[model samples]
Target: MHSKFKFFLFALTLYFPFTVWSHTPSDSISTEQDITPVLINAYFSQQPILGLTSSAQTINTRFLEAQQTTTLLPAVNTVAGVRMEERSPGSYRLAMRGSLIRSPFGIRNAKIYIDDLPLTDAGGNTYLNLLDPAGIHAIHIIKGPDGSLYGANSGGVINIQPEGFDVSQNQTSLLLSGGSFGLFQEQLSIQRKVDNNYNFSVDQSFTRSDGYRDNTKLHKKTLQTAHRWQYTPKNDLRFFALYSNLGYRTPGGLTRDQMEENPRMSRPAAGPNPSAKAQQAGIYNKTFYGGITHRAQLHPKLSHTVSIFGSNTDFENPFITNYEYRKENNLGLRTYFSYENIDHPQVKWQMQLGFEGQKGWYKIDNYDNEQGVSTDPQAKDNLDNIQHSFFYRAMINLYTRWTIEGSIGLNQSKIAYNHRFPEITNASGRINFGGIWMPRIATSYRVHKRLALRGSVSKGYSPPTIAEVRPSNQTINSELKAETGTNYEIGGRIETANRRLIVDLSMYHYQMDNGIVQQRNDRAEDYYRNAGEIKQQGIETSVWTYVLVPNRQRFIQALNVHSSASYNHYRFGNYEVAEQDFSGNKVTAVPDWVWTNTVLMSFPKQFGLNLSHNFTSAMPLNDENSVFSEKFHLLQAKGTWMWSLKNKRQLQIFAGIDNLLNERYSLGNDINAFGNRFFNPAPTRNYYGGMKIVL
Candidate 1:
């Protein structure tokens, strides 16, 4: 039924406009008008957004830029329950909601995207390694579960939207910078619309650095291209593509003494060991990912998008040990369209339908003593895995402010083995249904023109990922179930008399049943099982006010302070570990309190400064305090200046320092790469500068 309906819509849209009166060319708008709106669609929703169900919990781009953060992690870290980690500046890992240890193989939790195209790898890790944060125009994190819309991995979702094009203006921007740890970055982007209907956009970026430790170094490059064709007054078609390559080296983790005394040290071994064997000391890796996306406007306010993406990742352990991974491949396809035809004054309705699928395989090989050794026999049944999935979702909007969303999915996955292991089979996979209903009803009585009381409640659920189903060893033993939860939040937004005071407060109570947790198996003793009931309740608040407002002639215009705070209580259910009675044990890594405050001083036409302070409560690095991670505060600052000559030319300067205090702090447990070290060494202190030109 859905397929037939989709076809009908397509046919109707293809017919010449002789019979369609509602279709209007987007270009009909005055060409002199600013194109910022079309390029950044999500921003139109200023206050608590209610339109795009994808990001009911809004975090505007301006709010992020205010922090002077260069990556997605820093900008998103302040959101309650969302934690992002970086072993160094080159690697980033993120987890949303409860601190659950997702599987390390094949698409784990969390669905990620770069400009509507999936960025998730087979191992469930997002390919943030290749991204240059400066290229992003806006990002919206749906917070909580989004499995209903995007199939598989429900740990919460992040949607990134890039800049589009302008039909009336030919614009270009460039930025270059050098920072601590031998880091250097460059970015260039250009977009222009020709005539009144065709537009082109291009972007390129490169980054390289010596890194913070004994073996941390990274190099990356990216190129992006996009074309928009307004076929007619009523129809538009767009094409976009991205190419990214990344290379990095990591010095293995060290013991407690090695971490505290000399934070810049590394083990260089392939596995956990204190020995100085050069074979296992460090590792080098290279990865590449690229994809294409297409979007078409079928009718007024109705559009469809389709994308195809793939990646190849390779890594080698240059340590004394000859462990290595030659390559892993992933391919994905996605399609979705939304219809927003709420043109009626008395009643309104909107509908959204989407489907997504990913197919991929991974290989891990044991190498001979030599560097690039390969054995023909061992490569046959090779350590390989395939993950395939499909989902169907629908969201209906009744009236302007009410929404209900639901989705069901089919998942089939397996790990391949040689004939040597007849005991290993791939029939244990299972299918599941997951999604959320975020019904937001905000009645703005309007206290004058800028303030109102806004309240909302949202329910979210995340399903287990492909890796969780098939651990390192695949079998039929107790298959784990997806952890399902709800995020109930109530919040109010305030806009003051002078329009300079912006305040937001929100309280959330989260609960999960049969959540996926790591538990010591009673039978195997050392092996682990997935089982648990968990709860996390927290409150988040933010205040952004302007201490100074600049005038047209002054250029030094606004001084704003933004602060947010959160307190979360996380604990296990009636469960025990190591035969110890442990009913009230706190989960590892999920801190009890976290907060961040940023002050931004902006000069409309000249320069700007941003300073931020962040704090995280002491968290048990391991289950016991023996490996406790102490709490610490980190400070950062950045400045930007713009210069212009006369017509058609402009230059912008940017510089910043991260870890300005050089505060040594651990980013908390992410993947437990270093089993026992409570803290992962942060960079000492580094400063960087860059310049951008627009033509």
Candidate 2:
């Protein structure tokens, strides 16, 4: 028997009954006393999820509190087509639908927004780690190429909403947690409503950890506030601001032999490469971002919304190779006018027209590293980027059973750079990508009262990010073209009459041309090139149900189960490099199968237990499919007790264990490494205990 098959069978047997979980969340929490029916709402408007023509999901505060609150890694992984990894304490990588091929560290090929403000810059990069998890109240994901509305993305879109944005509640909370590996966290949140038309929220948090590996300590502090005012019956205004200071050590990747010898050791010297410990590899970053939005009702059926935002970042990185410093400034605007006729006797229609634009200025300098200090100058570059998109969308509902939607966007971008140190090409040239059109059409039909079917066709276009054009190798490649693809999808949703059982299924195929790929030179410096083509196809499904309802006579008050799975068959096409053809090989760094499950049980005396398990299959490490990582299973458990105090106060305590199986694995691996230095071992079994006070 094959070892992979045997291991898969063993894992399935170990956690089959305890593995069901759901990503779509209800508006209210489900406790021992309250079992509200699950209601999935749309992000754009007050509509039901089943009526939408696209694949979407939401994770609310209840789902976030189920996992360790220090990071969003576990909670985000529950979505079938999404993957998030934490290489070290503060480093993060995320992908949607196998989009990780172009991302080395941060988030790329996707668009991210905090409410109406853009988190992704004009250069097509997102620093996802800057936002603390405590300030994030909910996450909504559109799980395909949504460029027709968001612009310049092949992966998808993620919108992070702060607390009190969608709710009208006054509350104050404090949370403290301590865990293994010398981890500690403190957070405070305040939400207040002044009168019926004004509300505000403030969130502050601090976190520190001594990681499991050498030179991997981390600490971060963040403060965020939001305000909303309905000054008049026809006008609304909103403001958001954030500040974050973060610092973390970088324990570089290790080879298989080095990992087996000592998993806790930092990257060691090989050939001309210096040891990570000797170089004191680390990163430090400080950033500030703020935005304001206004909306007004122009007529009975017309409305207008506008938002303006700006940000600044000071970033420093001391690596084994060099010391890097960068200062970035960004500003952007988004405005739209919407018209609706939803009260029609037979047909309901709506249309939206919008324009979004952003500009950025960046100064980057590199110098020789002398024990984490900047010394001899190596290179200095100044660059600026401009991006804009005009888009429109229309949707119609016929007879309240059939719906159709269409959207189109035209995007343009330009980049100019100056090589200041070499005094060569000093702002003399610019790269312009002419206007590109992205369009999407989708339809949904209600076959029955409890069933709906949806289909969509869309186009995707993503230009090379700034990092890809001028990577660590410090070379500018102007010939690289943007990657483009067309995606086709079909999906369905089913629900029971009582809403106790719900299921969603989808399948998609995408053919991409001029795909961007990453490579490392002999000196272990990163570069990029274009692959000819790629073929991506996948199937995703999710199920959520309640096995038992709340009962007074039974010890188990309630039991809820949820499960989701993904099967991917991704391959390279027409890919040839240096006389080697990898056209038929499997895609690098993407697993063939991924499954997640979770179970929640409520007991007497306000005690509840939650258990979750994740299984990931082996995946190829390089384009040639020569080597693969090991398959692993992860198990987690948490128990909580709550008490209702006097004066409408509540106290809750939680303790949790992660990696219950203690299996060895790498959550994030360096693909196509120079010397097979790919593995970055994840943490072992750990425990955490925390308490929350709510008033």
Candidate 3:
């Protein structure tokens, strides 16, 4: 047996003695809540989960806290067909369905919103890692293309609800945690429901870690606040603000041989390229983002909502080839008007019209990197981007069992750049992507009291991001085109009458043209190109159940299980590069199968246990499909004990282990990397322990 597993078993023996010490039978049944149906705002419909005409999933706070509190990867990965990865402590990448192609790092080809505010900028980029996990109360995900409601996406949409919106009582919490690799984290949160008409929440967090690999270190601090006010009987106002300062070192990638020799080593120095440590490769960012929204009911059948948001960021990155700095500013607005016939019971209908727009200004400068110091200037540029979309949606229900909906959107985008250093003729140039129309139709029918079926056909469109247009190589690509696709999907939901068991299944086929692909040069600099065509088909399913109800006399007070799985058949079509044809090749970076399972057990005396397992199949690393990555399994476990205090206060302590099987794998890999340097090994077996106090 592995030494780590032996130590973990010994620790469990010491803890089992404590579990036997039970509390009074009159105490609370269990800290875990029963699995119940909840209302969701999917496709602008505020209805129960069973009435949706789209593939959707929701993640709550309890599920998030069951794993590590420092990162959202574990919680988000519980959703089928969704993948989130972290190359290092503070670096994050997210993908919905098979949209991972265009993204080398960060979030792309997807739309993200916090409440009604757009978190993704006009240039189609999202800084998802900046937000602390404690500040998020819930997440709602809509699978497949949703361009009719949200603008410009091929991957889907994610809406995050902050802490204050769901608070039912006033509470303050402080959490402190420490784990392997010199990891330390602290978070303080305060949520107050000031009377019945107003509520607010504040969250502050700081985290630092000396990572498992050489030259990989991370530190971040964040402050977030949210406020909601029912100023009048028919009007409501909401505001949210966040500030974050983050810095992390990049360890780079290693070859297969190098990894086998020493997975803990950073990228070694090649002929002309310096090692990651010698070059001081890292990324630093200081950003501030905020937004406000107002919702009013003009009349019984009419309503309106408007939101305004803005953000400013100062970013610095030092790589082996160059040192780059960027200053970015963005502002946007979203407003919608709705008309509904709520008074009629036999037949109901609704119509909505909305507009979303955003503009961004950016300044970028590159200099020679002399071990992280800025030396002679290399390149400089000023760029501006503007994007907008107008959309309309209509829905009708015949009786309360059948729903039909249709929607359309018109989008336009343009970019202008002025080259400053090493200038040439027409130093200023503009690229305008003409107007495009996206449409969607969907329907859902409740066959019986416990079953429902739904189907949808939607169009997907996504333009190249700013980083893709002018990649690290510092060259502009004027010939690149936007990616467009159409998706056909069918899904069903089944639930037990008591809401104790629920299952969701969905299947989709997406055909895309002008697919964006990421590439790297011999110098390890990134670039982008367009693939001719691609085809993707997949099936996703999830299950949630409560196997045992809470009982005071039972040793196992409650038992809950949640599982999700995905099967993908993704391949290239009519794709050719130079002299090589990749037609019928498997899509790079996407696995053929992925499965995740989680089990939660609640015992007497407010004691809880959680176990999670994830399995991923092998995937291709390059477009040619000549090289592949190995499959791996991950196991994680956590245990918690809570005690009630005076004045309705509480104290909790938790300890957890990740990668209990001591697997060797990469959480994030550099796909299609230069010189076959693809692997970035994840941490080995690790452990964490934390304490929290609530008042």
Candidate 4:
């Protein structure tokens, strides 16, 4: 069984070489300060993950708001090869590592960013559920394909760090929440500094549900803002804006005998003209974004950064037959420059040179949902996309226990369709895709002083998004291309020496050559091809620990533990369709054990508690791995209490529970579904409670 779970995670990291001690030794910073906010937000200047060499993870939305879940799938699945899926409640899908076999939902071949602009567009979709997980305060994952310097993306790279540009001091807050099926939420936040070189922040939220099934309803609203300016100490500026409005409802997959007979049905009407809840099928969105950033230092070993962004979207769906409408717009720019040479302080070096560009335009339209009143006009298109990338990176540091890095990226993308429906005369078209080049090399070493060892070799490129070349079965394929890959990795990390146990491990192998699949056609429409090859290998692990009790009437004052695991072994190489050669099969929605665990406590007044568990295994819902999908175990719990009111104001309360072993599971399925509908049920025992107020 995966070599006895990789020899029990290598004998439990060689018998737990201690590591989890988040903070200690902060006598006002300056022991060469490096407070790991995922290594100071990795890239875009802040570095320090010791010898750094790839595979990243950083999440701290205050530990995902202690599970008062507002989705982001429980804080990005507690990171370990990452996977997040929420097939309903404003649908979201994310995968990195197994890459969701060309995601049939949102977020595809990942590459997202928030503070550093670009939320994956210009054809590489990513609507990260339109922000509002309380405006995320941090998340930085970069796993698998290091896309040379983050451009194309063969599933990896996500950086969201929003929450008013790092607040510190002036504050205001309010939050309320309710639970079970008819959940509700309201939130507000405000921050200000406005002086010592400007600062401001704002956040707004509203949420609604009634979900647990039956055309799963959901509603959302968000508004976010951040502003910061330093304008001097070598220059700085930052600004961001966001607005969102979303509407959901689309309970559409079922058949595992209608999810074992009504797991809250919705998706039944086959040869008829109704259902999808009689055509009230859902999805509606509205978005607007803005950005501006700049950082400078002219010379002090030279530095520079720049960003400018824009976005607009207005989408609508309605589906039982069709009623789609979109209107998107994009604009982007990113610039970079960096150069360093610590003048041989043991030989150090740094380099970065960058460019990024985007341009998008879409204006789809399709109609014919007779029940929801959208008569004829079967199609109307107008797409336009352009993406550009240029990247270079170099890092070197020897003597500080070795480190090396190299990177490269050069991409160019294109699209243009324009079929203004005149009854679609052969689908007017244009498609250009040619430039691609990606490369990477990494190294790290520093065995002991807490240990480290890393390695990497990378290359990946993805393309074919514009909703997978005009999807929704609207047909625009134009010989879909682009999906290259190569990756190899090795990893290690250890800790002890009084840090209480921390571990990380990695192993990877990836291969791809035109691997993009997503299909369905017995009139359930949706299509995508290429799957000539595919392969993936994996093993990932993570752990963190804590214990601490040392007296004080002991009502438990610490006891954390965190975990993550993955073991995939995907397949399908030299695949064939129609003529059916499924090569080595099994690679359909990956799963070969994925695990997560958590436990936390902390008491004595500010009380706290957390417990979690997750496990998944059975998978392969198609490509002849013959219908599989069912294997789950989940449990959750949360609790909190805080009330320190006297000037610095505070008052918190929280509660949670979810599927506490009431697992009927299928947090998202539909892999290669057509008729067998492939279940989507998920959500059984639920509960929630909340409160927050800080002024």
True-structure RMSD, every candidate? 12.0, 2.9, 3.8, 24.2
**Best of the two (3, 4) by TM-score:** 3
Question: lDDT per residue, candidate 1, 131-245, as tens digits?
Answer: 6565565666655454445544445666666555333577777767777778777778787777688887787888887877766677777787767677777665665566676
Question: TM-scores across all candidates?
Answer: 0.78, 0.95, 0.96, 0.34
Deviating ranges (above 4 Å) for candidate 3: 1-35
**Collision count for each candidate, in order:** 23, 7, 0, 7
**Candidate number that wins on TM-score, 2 or 4:** 2
Best-to-worst ranking by TM-score: 3, 2, 1, 4
lDDT-superior candidate, 2 or 3: 3
lDDT of each: 0.54, 0.83, 0.87, 0.79
User: What lDDT tens digits, residue by residue, belong to model 2 across residues 156-240?
Assistant: 8898888756546778889999999999999999989877899988999999999989989999999999998999999999999
lDDT of 3 by residue, 373-482 (tens): 98999998888999899999999987889999999999888999999987788888999988899999999999986799999999999998888887888887778899
Superior candidate under lDDT, 3 versus 4: 3
Minimum summed lDDT over a 10-residue window in model 1 is located at: 16-25
lDDT, candidate 3, residue 515? 89
Q: Give the least accurate 10-residue stretch of model 4, judged by summed lDDT.
A: 21-30
Winner by lDDT between candidate 4 and candidate 1: 4
Ranking by lDDT: 3, 2, 4, 1
60: Cα error in model 4, Å: 15
Error of 4 at 590 (Å): 31
